[model samples]
Target: MSVKETAQEVLKKIGGSKNVESVTHCVTRLRFVLRDFSLPNKEEVASIDGVISVIEQGGQYQVVIGNKVSEVYDEVLKELDGSDPTDKIESKAHHKSLFDKFTAMISGIFMPVMGAMAGSGMIKGVLAILTITNLLSEESGTYIILYGLSNAFFYFMPVILGASAAKYFKMDIFVGAVLGAALIYPTFIPFASEGELSFLGISVNMMDYTSTVFPVIVAVWFASKVNMIAEKFMPKDLKFLLVPAIVLLISVPVTLIVIGPIITLLSNVLADAVNAIYNFSPALAGAVIGGPWILMVMFGLHWAFIPIFIANMASQGYDPMMGLLLANQFAMAGATIAVGIKTKNDKLKALSLSTGVTTLFGISEPALYGVLLPNKKPLIAAIIGGSFGGVIAGIANTVQYSFGGSGLLGIPLIINTSGIDNGFYGGIASQIVGFIVGFALTYTWGFKEKSTVDSDDYSGNNTLLNTKINVNDILSGEVVALSEVPDKVFSEGLMGQGLAVIPNDGKVYAPFDGVVTMIFPTKHAIGLTSSDGIELLIHVGVDTVELNGVGFKSFVASDQKISKGDLLLEIDLAVLKQSNFQIITPILITNPDKFSKVSHENNNLILAN
Candidate 1:
């Protein structure tokens, strides 16, 4: 499906735009805050074509969309243009714990800026490479310009974060930016270093706000609350002018006097605590963090660490946490490759190999969800491998000088500002240990290929049926070839073959006398196993699962015995058609391998008999 289609499908399944309280995208996922959390079906969202997985954690509904998340995010934004107005309903977030709300706010503010941050970090990494090689002197004009390019984002972080945080807090974006600018206004910067200062006869706590995280976010939040009060009291005619004026007037001074110093201190404490843990025992810290890194990513808990990472970079100019994460990526890749090599299923082999390569490039969601996690053992092996890599990196005191790099490509990020050192070598060694150990362990005993017979390879099943199973049409409709069905799973015969029908009526009769094996909660599909052992699937419409059972009606319960002509389901054909869902129903022989001569006869005319 096209990215736009994926976005639309996702939007529909998540209760359309009305249910979304807010939405944002991080590196590889679309995070949503919803008004009604129960509206979305996790299974349906995950099954969307471009979606990798669905996670509900930290009070956010996250749909993993791999690397193209930004594109999908843009499309989602376009579709959400008419989203329900704020104040119309209370967000589900209000009931979440303080920590959940805080994480959501952090992710909302930081996610938009991460790309630029990563890009700037990469520029710094590249500059390091050039300077170390002696190809570019630090004193050169070119170096000066490149250095500025690398430093601009971090140096002016407050302004960028102000704009993003404004969106989250529902304040004027430029006003939020101006509030940030007030902290580092060029004329006011000198007083911070000069020590004692007073504003409006109140002693102002002077602190440099450059490259900071928490202060600006807190400031914007404060401004949003103040703006809300100003709106309520200020006269409508003068509200626009005075509200912002009053907001900036009150917010700027309050932040300089109160929020800035407090948050900065807390941020430092957090960063220091992290460093202390690593310092106490690098190997143990590495093992502890590395062991569950993939699981953290899966649950969307990793976003909580972004602030600490930025704080480390701001205070120490280097961060060790990223190295542990990179190790996990290599471990995931290694385990995935092993699965590819060991899996006997051709489809699984292709998926494993492709997702393995993606993991090597720093996108591990596909590998973790599609391959390793499903197999269980490979996931354990990957975690074990990552722990070892983390230990090695910890012992070497490896740190990332900048961000943006992951997997093997991120090796340059470990180069210390002084020059190439033991840390860089440690990073390389860690990845090697991670990949090799993950591969070796998984290859040795982590995986066992499950045997299955491919339909194309069937030899002994040619004449196995002792009696002919005559199938009848379950619905009155125009017969359509299964190969022409819109869904690939049916069109390609991947789910076995039968035929499709464009229904002119709603009722579905049993195709053969058998027990109903399954009935999807959405009621868009049903499964049956014939008395003679023929398994059949009757799916009402292509992509109709997104309808959430709105127009589908089940007439028979699962495990119920039925005759060939018994009523089974009732689809509201007009309702489905009105909603733009294709009403072409597919009747499939799910176990076509058991038949030798599966053919449609009598001009493909199927009738209940």
Candidate 2:
């Protein structure tokens, strides 16, 4: 197949150009950020020609194409350049499981800016250490600037979250940003402390929303819904301005009065429940938390633990749960380091080594997705190591004085204000024990290293590009761009790419050797599946399906074999014109993403090889 056709097949297998939000290439992979997870067929993607592997990591759909990925990436971009991609419409049709969907959402939302957030959290720890040690005075200008730098992202967490959430939720970004800002606005902070509040005669349950997760997410969600609903009644000319304006007006009030308080209360209740559990038994709590901690991190279930940890620090003097959970990070990192050393495959070694470095810095998505889960034995070893470490931490009553990442930066956060307290020393000891345990266990028991696939050996099963069109002559009609169609559904290229033809004659012919998949009862359209695996849908006229065969006749039967250029249908153009039905017949490749190119020329659509 030509390079152009290969890109089309690749794009289709990954859920099409519309599903992709962005595309780029690293050394060996075509990285795509898809709007919906369920739309891509992984099996088909893996079977594509020139693809070495498929990896879904940190919400990216990666096609491992070896060294030629950049060439393919360039082609993929060219093929999709003119298409105005849409997201939310495709998202609603996704069929992913709830856990998978939520994992994707969290990964997509946080992965982009996690470095900034983590860096700021680390600085907060630095600030705490500096103040406790008297190295920086609280009243000093140096300390004040550092404190502001450390606190900014956390203080404006709602706005940051809202902007990201809006991108994922398919709403206007600034609208999401403004809504988030309004939630944590300085004026509203005082209102939450008051007894009661009301907005437009509606009772408002005052709740502190600063640094909270669910409120802005809920607000953006409602805004997206409102935007969709408003599109119908909104005038086309005024839609660009009025739809977002109306959505913001409704969503902000609804969020403050209805959504914000409910989610905050839930967060508080969750925090209290977790604290009660921690108070029940420290060792048991550590065991339970550590054993599945990486798994929680993997699916982002650990986000639920964040507010709880903060609450413990706020209500009490310090948080023990976060310290207890710290072993999991070092343990996983150690296990991955062992994998890097033990693996025979060059790619696996590189992946494990880089991911190990990432985990050492408290980012475990790379380690979990790229190594541990794929290598089952190492994951088990890491869990066991973490469990042992957690027991030691719990017994030592490990606690942290300030917020920081769970990697090396955590050590300073747990340091004692006094010389050498058990809480601080024990916390340090637990991590060392966890790393040794994990590295030893994994190095001794090892993972089964799966060698890379020889890309040349596993050739693709289909011959889509090899099959000839049989009728090479230009089609007899007036071929037009998809946007020229009267219906928005067709004009938007939503039903798949092809052309609307104003046919001078009634005849419609089979474009390739295929089996008739269906003949519409009304006879306005015929569906055929090509021998090479293409699907073609030929509609005789716009909305003519409603005519009930009044102005159309289909000559093919379902399951019948068809040859190229065989007469399949005839339409009574005069009857359709008289009845006010459009005679602009549309020849649509219903699964246009399956082809390398769908181009209109001299009254013909040349599906490229």
Worst 10 residues of 2 by lDDT: 450-459
Report the C-alpha lDDT of model 2 over 1-609, residue by residue, as the tens digit: 666777889988777778888665654567687777666655457557666557665556877665466688889999778577543344644445666565666655654456677677678677767877888898999998998997787678789888988887777888888899989888778877776678888888776677667678878988889988999899899999998789889998899888887877776788778878878988888888876787775444765455566556555647878778778888889999999998786777897888787777776656765577656778888898888788878888888756766778677778654444787777877887888888889998846443221223223433533432322221357766656665533554435556677778788888878899999899887888989887776767666765789967778899999998888887778998776676776566665445554444434454545
Instruction: Give model 1's TM-score versus the native structure.
Output: 0.74
Estimate the TM-score of every prediction: 0.74, 0.61
Model 1, 1-609: lDDT tens digits are: 999999999999998888888888776789898888867766568778999778777888989898789899999999988665653654453367877777778877887788898889888988888889899999999999999999999989999999999988999999999998888888777878787578889998788888888999999999999999999999999987899999999999999999998999998888889888888998888898875887876765777788898888887898888766558888889999998998776887898899899889887887887778766789999999999999999888888878785886687688776789988888888888899889999999788653221323323342543433333367887876776676545664546667788888899888678999999999999999978787888899887887899988888899999888888888899898787677888887766545544555432321111
In angstroms, how far off is 135's CA in candidate 1? Answer: 0.9
Clashing pairs in 1: none
Best prediction by lDDT = 1
Candidate 1 Cα misplacement greater than 4 A, ranges:
82-94, 453-609
Q: What lDDT does each candidate get?
A: 0.81, 0.72
Clashes of each: 0, 0
RMSD (Å) of each candidate, 1 decimal: 8.5, 16.1
State, as a TM-score between 0 and 1, how close model 2 is to the true structure. Answer: 0.61
